[model samples]
Target: MSNPTLDLIRAHGSCRRYRPDDVSNEMIESIVEAGQRASTSSNMQAYSVVAVTDAAKRAELARLCGQQKHIAQAPVFLAWCADLARLDRACQLRELEQSSEHVENFLVAAVDAAIVAQNAALAAQSLGLGICYIGSIRNNPREVIQLLELPRLVFPVTGMTIGWPEKPPRTRPRLGLEAVLHRERYNPNQDEALLAYDREMAATGIYEGRQVEIPGRPGEMEAYGWLEHSARRVAQPMRTFLREVLEEQGFLLK
Candidate 1:
């Protein structure tokens, strides 16, 4: 089947380098409008996107996001947020109690935010713009909350940098369908698929000329394959403070 949308998705890659040219306001508005068209939980629309364009703010955001230069250089930096604050305010106006602190509510808001952000990314890509998602925005969640002036019941979910691409990047390899898809029931046997994918990725030179040393193991190293890289990533605690941050934001209360 010939499908332009699937083809575009398959060819998509994270854009780290971008041209100095700005994405026009009309395009940004269209992109965000596309995002707004995405389905929301109970039509609550619990997501908000903070568009940051100021040079000084971008620099601070880049610093907060682990010094990712692309964030500062991108023409647009959008801070996607899971927001229940507006719902709470709505409840207040009607003299109704707000249950925004529930874990289910948090999940709903986060999922809504992610779906909308992906829609916006796809819209930007369709317009010849490139985007890179910055999960490192959680590195300093408190700072991000303060910087964006997020109220209670609102939390920064992720950041995205969007701009005109300076150059096209090679499409990265992904796990085969067998590794991710199940017919009738869940499959627990993924070792074979994972190993095959690791080999395929290594052969593609995706992580070529890079050294990924095993933590706490000196002199005993192996090829930095996808399995090794991903294993190392999960071996240690990443974003351990997220729970605390969410709790502070009046969420995840079961």
Candidate 2:
């Protein structure tokens, strides 16, 4: 019942509610250390983290993230930044030419930032903390950048709201193993597998009951099924707020 590994991976789930308890400063540092331990490309290790505890800042961040109230509710909001600025500035301080101005270096930093952030999330979950990634952070990157005082060569890849859970959440069912794993190849049988998985999801009644504010009919990521909710997501072209924000932040993905 106390497998540390399962505590890290298997039991990990996104939790939005909080009990008003604060995450201790030491725990926050440990969680950050876990993030720093994540593998990086070429050991480049290019990333920075901005921990936002200010209520006003979190409220604005919540607004930027599709107005998700949890962003504001959580006692801590960590913004994982893909930062080449620090490296560049260090280079400049030594009167050396900057090498990370290229697209490859930029992408490398961004990808590494995401990897590390997930590492932190899992670490928090293992330490009895709840976390929910706010991908909508990209919707208004300029504002976030300004609020965080990020430099030009740095970008906020994503934000996560973390806190103690108010109540435990049930485990959600996953698709059969065959649906995802491959045998030394990339072959996929999409139609049959998806159909079967959809039915299984429906039978669980995960999406049957929910209150959705979107223009379309009712949908639920919390309930009737994961498949139908995913269907609704792809049914209409979702906003590319991330793309817009990246461009605004000078992420010329050439």
Candidate 3:
């Protein structure tokens, strides 16, 4: 059976290079509408998307996003924000205190934003557009918040660059289903699967000639394979200040 949706998802890949063509406003609106149609937590829809088309703003955003040139070149840059500020305004209108300061609310907002952004990405893919998610926006969330004029109870979760691809990107590999799917109970014996996946990934030339910094060993370097690359990323604190930033945003107040 040919499942178009599954096929589309299976063929997904991040596109960094795009054509110089512009995405029509109508297409952008339709994509965002698809995003809005995603399931929301408690129907709160605690998320917002800011579309940046200005050249200067995109340049600034690219700098904030670890100086990624693709962000600046993309026709549309969408910042997906976990936004509870609107909910707070809604509470004020009803003369009720906002409860978005709790950890649960923050989780809900972040999840909502992620789900919505995925929906938008799928829609864009269906329209023959390519997209790449920029998680590096978290490297300096404070600056991104300031640049986007984000209020309290709102923070950028991720950004997406969308446009017509200059060329089809190579599909990246993923872990086997057995590695992630647990039936009756959680399976602890994952080493074999991990090792097998590591070999398979090593055969691919995707990370060839790339240098990766291992955690706890500052000057130490390693070949960029999936296992080592991912391990290094998880071994250290990528965003140590996120908790403090969330606290400043009135989240994680228990």
Candidate 4:
């Protein structure tokens, strides 16, 4: 029931601090090969990865991603892209009209990018490399597009920093299986599991001093947990310009 792969998967944790070391090109290619083995929608393979090691570019990327220092510290920064530009070329080769503007098409490409990136992540972990996924790559989408020289119909879905961990990474707790998994139909009544998880997470002190204060609320909270933190995140408007950016990238999202 237990194996190295499963152990690696369970041991997975995001590494923000990295030691100063270079990732070999051969190892990078091997990781990419693992990513390429991920399943794709209709074999369209609508994704691409840009591996950046240039010091200046990595600094700029770190700036674009809300100044995450790990990006600049890591030996390699990978920009995983949802790429339909190649699909457009394929249609041109066949002299056929391509339908890449639909929302469904965009979803397929985004999902493809995510799956491949996770495969690459696991591969890197297997090789004793640490990685941290940077969703803030979209903080300055247009600048990122320009910086990475991404063509139309190609969007950077996410980024990842890769290097040797400065120390052993800490594994964070996740919601209980009862909260996420249902037997058959979706179960809306999970308050019991939710409160239990809140207690479990509160004991870790991960959100200490980071509790969000909602406007119009009078008093400070006595207990802060995952639900409150997640609520604070969900309550805020994030990436509101993404629709416009997608349109500019040739994904009409119709």
lDDT, candidates in the order shown? 0.91, 0.80, 0.91, 0.92
The better candidate by TM-score, 2 or 3, is 3
Query: Model 2, which residues run further than 4 Å from truth?
Result: 1-3, 94-96, 99-103, 209-224, 241-244
In order, how many clashes per candidate? Answer: 0, 8, 0, 0
> Tens digit of lDDT per residue, candidate 3, span 76-115?
9999999999999999999999877677898999999999
Clash pairs (backbone) in predicted model 2 = 205-224, 206-223, 206-224, 206-225, 207-223, 207-224, 207-225, 208-224
lDDT of 4 at 157: 95
Q: For model 4, give the 10-residue run with minimal summed lDDT.
A: 209-218
Which TM-score value belongs to model 1?
0.94
lDDT (C-alpha) at residue 8 in model 3: 92
lDDT of 2 by residue, 24-137 (tens): 889889999999999998787889999998888889889888899889999999999898777777788999966654578778988999999999998888788999888787
Once fitted onto the true fold, the runs of candidate 1 whose alpha carbons sit more than 4 angstroms away are: 209-222
Which ranking of candidates, highest TM-score first? 4, 1, 3, 2
TM-score of each: 0.94, 0.85, 0.92, 0.95
Least well predicted 10-residue stretch by lDDT in candidate 2? 214-223
For candidate 2, give the lDDT: 0.80
Query: How far is each candidate from the true structure, as Cα RMSD in Å?
Result: 2.3, 4.6, 3.2, 2.0
